[model samples]
Target: MKIATPNDRLKQIMKERNLRQVDVVKMSEYYQRELGVKLTKSNISQYVKGTSNPDNKKIQLLAKTLKVSEGWLSGYDVKKELVVSKSELSNHFDKIFQSDKIKLDLDFANQKYENQEHKLTFLALLENFDKLEEDKRKNLLHYSDVLLESTYQKDEYNIVATMFDNSMEPTYSEGDRLMVSFGFDFKFGEDYLIEYKEDILIRRLFFENYKILLVPLNDKHPTTTIILPLKDHFKVIGKIIGKIKTSP
Candidate 1:
């Protein structure tokens, strides 16, 4: 199969949206007006004509104006919206906008896609872990390069999360990191990162007659354990695989 270049994909998306090159020019102007960045028509034309490539910021602007996801234009089958930070944009700008002839090596791109398709993509939280409920923790701080071999689905096998507090104690303190295996099924008396009362917590879980018990390891705390029904409010995010301390 003939793979499309980024510019080719851009052209295709524009056509799908019934947009002309002039429309893209207008959108570039709009992006400049809104972000205080120079989105030149020349640059946009270069991107469309395969003469140059836009950086992440420009690509984001174009994607927004074109009403498409970045993944779609890059030919990744994705549904979620992607957010690129200004710092990341600057880095991409330095790399891509340097040369006039932007070559999209389809072979390398295809190889990278194939390599990462089965790779486990573990994500860290963008916001405070305590503030985010299990379902609300949608924003990813970053994607780890580490990959693990597993037959389970991609989401199920990906694991590990940074510690938010000293809740787990001795096992994992505040600022420590926990490696987890989402693919590993839970067992009684096992440590896991779980969601209870909308909070992501690390605790030992025990199963009993349609109920789950969350027990903390810290003996200083009076609350020995928390018991809740095995229902919506309770869920196991991942089983603890390993732990890393931030400092001595």
Candidate 2:
């Protein structure tokens, strides 16, 4: 459909596309009620004679029926190109990935092992998943004590984690994730991802005055904070330096 006499352009599109005037009515009502109308003549003439003119909305509807742009119907679509091939899309994707860098986001304590090996090794952790029986989660607590015995300072626990639970919402939402560094400097209002009571995995952590508070990301959810009284057993295991969400 072009901006010539509406009758002439309508006839031209009908001839070129093997479409009937009634087909235009049907197409105009796409995904809508069926239209039953005569089509011998006077279809496009109603608009051409200035007896009636389509508003912007009707023009858009008519253009959609003709598989053309509303701009084309109004004589403005001539400058636009509307189609692109799959190869063009592939080329576009290639251009962006060419400069994308994949870096290892490791904990500050593990900064000594920043090379690609860390990524490979960290991913190796996944291989052990299947071997970790469901009931073994509690047993893993034993490993924590043994792992903590190393006393390598915060720098040695080179891993970061985010709490995985819906206990926090809105403020922390169920899926809101965070990044943590074992050596992350404490800030008054900032939160930390950490473990409480060896079993409670939670997300909100803040420092006020001299007390460290493991607040829930969402106050609406159940949350509690423990004050460190210089007891290693009652301490933050890791700083939630980052999060990789697996589900909502």
Candidate 3:
């Protein structure tokens, strides 16, 4: 028995897809245009030969182009398919609704509302509800619940989102449910969920004179700094008030 390496997975997928090294290089160009990352013929050759491994960004691009899971491509023993079953999605949402932290009224659809805006929104959703696909309807209902919870809840922390990376390891691991409050008043030494360019990151904040530093708890990741005047693309989505740990 032998352990599978990324090289093995890469070769396996290439063979399955009937793709050549040149084909991969050409296909990667399409993703590079959008991701602004380069993957050359040499990079692909080295990856297949086990001479080198692809970095995180390249791994993502490769996964998307090759149509496989990042974990699987990285040689992890996981499902190759990225698709989630309808039952699994339903179970995930059920956990959210059943959580004690959330107080979303499930019967809002039947209850009468005095607010004209709320009434109109619910009416519109009801009118077009049947036209939407099953998955879209579920997403719309979840969005509506979150929106209502944020609007009516007295607490500052109204939104709930899952942490997707290990950048905040020890303090917050991946799959942890983060209770985030929407605000722009950034306090130093606090953890925040921020939108930097196209990526959402969870980082601890530190102010140094005229610069704002985004520091990760995991020292493997380097700290990012932004000057006092934030760029148009940079935005602080919210402060992380609390987190529900999913793993021990």
Candidate 4:
């Protein structure tokens, strides 16, 4: 007969997701870096113990990190799911591609193909590309290279690299072929292949206070922090735009 409090909802969701206070601490660190909201293990413990409540900005950060709705996290009688708007999705895509040097010309493709069937065929080819035999895959790759060479001049952005480590696992596997865009423009919250201290590594970038945080997706790996004004210590090889899995 008692109304649930924000602490109660937070405890419920954390229990449901098997997230401990320490896990929240680590996860909230990521949001802290991205959203510039400060959170600590002590804060999480206080919230869990119902001794303190998070402010609006902290509530928003928690909701995003926990993949729940802010209203639900705030103990409102709303659905727990987070509903993302189309504009939000559009803005996310814009943030990714707006700074890229290579532009995908979907309009040009439509104009050249002209027929819906042709578009469908191209889609089918893309869908079945990985399923093709080794010889067929080579042939397709050759054909693609020929088309691209004829269409556009080769640039440094044409670099493609294969993942040889599990440091970025789950999101990118060991054998995945990463399509890289060569640049030094480090966008926060996006993954990039970087060269630092003579080692080439892939990490998600973030800027906090005046430090650059290079975070690995696999938490087992350590996050590297560099001081501002990067200097000669850091070099960005490229940003990872897309990837191809070697296996199904």
Candidate 5:
């Protein structure tokens, strides 16, 4: 009997839910924002196309978010209702991989860092963040033991995202880099990074009884006052706290 692979099972589940690729992308982002797990579009494509597999932690989260059992999702055993442990998954990857060169390189780098007296500087790589796959990146970081710089101090819940449009001109310009804080207190007539209808926008939020209004500051831009159901289509990603204007 031919048993289904994890990829096959994922496709089946997605099919059952009538989910598209873009829907999966949204689900992955939702998972990351709520759970701190990075699941990108690349990761979803890889998983569905059999190019890669998620770790046990990701596997569990995937099952929970997709409304499936771990065993069924991974195609381990149809009757077994269990989740694979992290250690077991790590051991599985190690055994399956033919080359250990990447692992060896990481080990050597770790030793060098341990013996060095210089302070290590860590900066968030801002380029192409939307294009990165969370699961693959997490696995690489785990395997390499890379430690990211802490943002727990004043910048806690803060992220830097570049603005590509001039919709909020005078307040925000094209090519400006914004320092967005996810922990900001929401208020009426405030500019925010909003998620609406599966699109990300930087606009002003207005209060209404049954609907919320997304208004642009620039009148010349001709943005229609988008009236959306208060809680359904509107999501606040973060508030724009600061900006770094690019020199013309």
Candidate 6:
């Protein structure tokens, strides 16, 4: 009744699971560059031959990437995914990755799959804009973060959107939230919310030849809200793509 060693367990799992060497190799492809230069089939064969052992970091990623307990590799996983985000907190994770995050009261999550490709993560938007402050009749320039130079183009992307008591009511009312596409230069087909001389407007942009149009929602009251076209009196503050509403 003796306990099996880590390597012993590794050999056992490989055999019982009927896993091929290439199976492990293909898993490693996820971080081929970070773990080291891209590994070829020949390199994988070398590790199987015992003539070469993967580097420490490489081995950890290899084991985790393949869902094999690290114990099966470095003799023990009594350890973890060894996360180290670049200072930017922006360049570390991939387009999609399984890693970690500090959320609410959870002490530690075994895994947190991060998706970077999402223009703006839905959860992030929800958390930032759950409630609104009084005296603020508009959302423009509120939670907005201007991007002067980002890899993606779509200026003024909405990170947080809310809908309640807004001129956009009936169509957009209480308890609605939206995900926005942002960071492209101002143009038509793009709906922007701008404040002119401190007056706020949530409207769509339409350019017809030499004229421009800024149309608002709920026009039953009509001219009470002035409708203008390319007036020298205003500037483009921002655009509204989507919004979410919470209890007023």
Give the alpha carbon lDDT tens digit for every residue of 89-154 in model 1.
Answer: 344323322210111122234455555453332111112333556433221211221111121123
Candidate 6 wrong stretches, greater than 4 Å = 1-158, 161-166, 174-182, 185-187, 221-233, 245-248
- Candidate 5 whole-model C-alpha lDDT, 0 to 1: 0.57
lDDT winner between candidates 3 and 6: 3
The better-scoring model by TM-score among 5 and 6 is: 5
- lDDT tens per residue, model 5, 20-87: 76566544543454466877778888988888878887776677556457778777666422344546
Local distance difference test scores for all models: 0.53, 0.43, 0.67, 0.66, 0.57, 0.43
Best prediction by TM-score: 3
* Model 1 TM-score (2 dp): 0.36
- What is candidate 3's lDDT per residue for 172-230, written digit by digit as tens? 76445577776547689999877776556789988899998999999988999888787
lDDT tens digits, residue span 124-206, model 2: 54444435575453333222211222232332334323223345554343323333355656654555544344343555566
Model 3 scores worst on lDDT over the 10 consecutive residues at 98-107
What's the C-alpha lDDT at position 204 in model 3?
94
The candidate scoring highest on lDDT is 3
Q: What is the lDDT of residue 240 in candidate 5?
A: 79
Residue lDDT tens for model 4, 1-248: 22577899989988865678877665555457567898888999999998999889989999877767788888888877676564653443343333221223333455567787697755654454446687655433432211223233333344455455567878885534466776447669998977787566788989999998999889988999998787757877788877632211
lDDT: worst 10-residue window of model 2: 97-106
> What C-alpha RMSD separates each model from the true structure?
20.8, 23.0, 14.6, 17.9, 16.8, 22.2
lDDT of 6 by residue, 10-92 (tens): 45545644456665454355455345546566655666556666666655666644445465556553532233234322222
Give me the overall lDDT of model 3. Answer: 0.67
Give me the displacement of residue 151 in model 3, in angstroms.
18
Each prediction's TM-score against the native?
0.36, 0.30, 0.47, 0.37, 0.36, 0.29
Pick by TM-score: 4 or 5, better one: 4
> Model 5, stretches more than 4 Å misplaced?
1-157, 223-232, 245-248
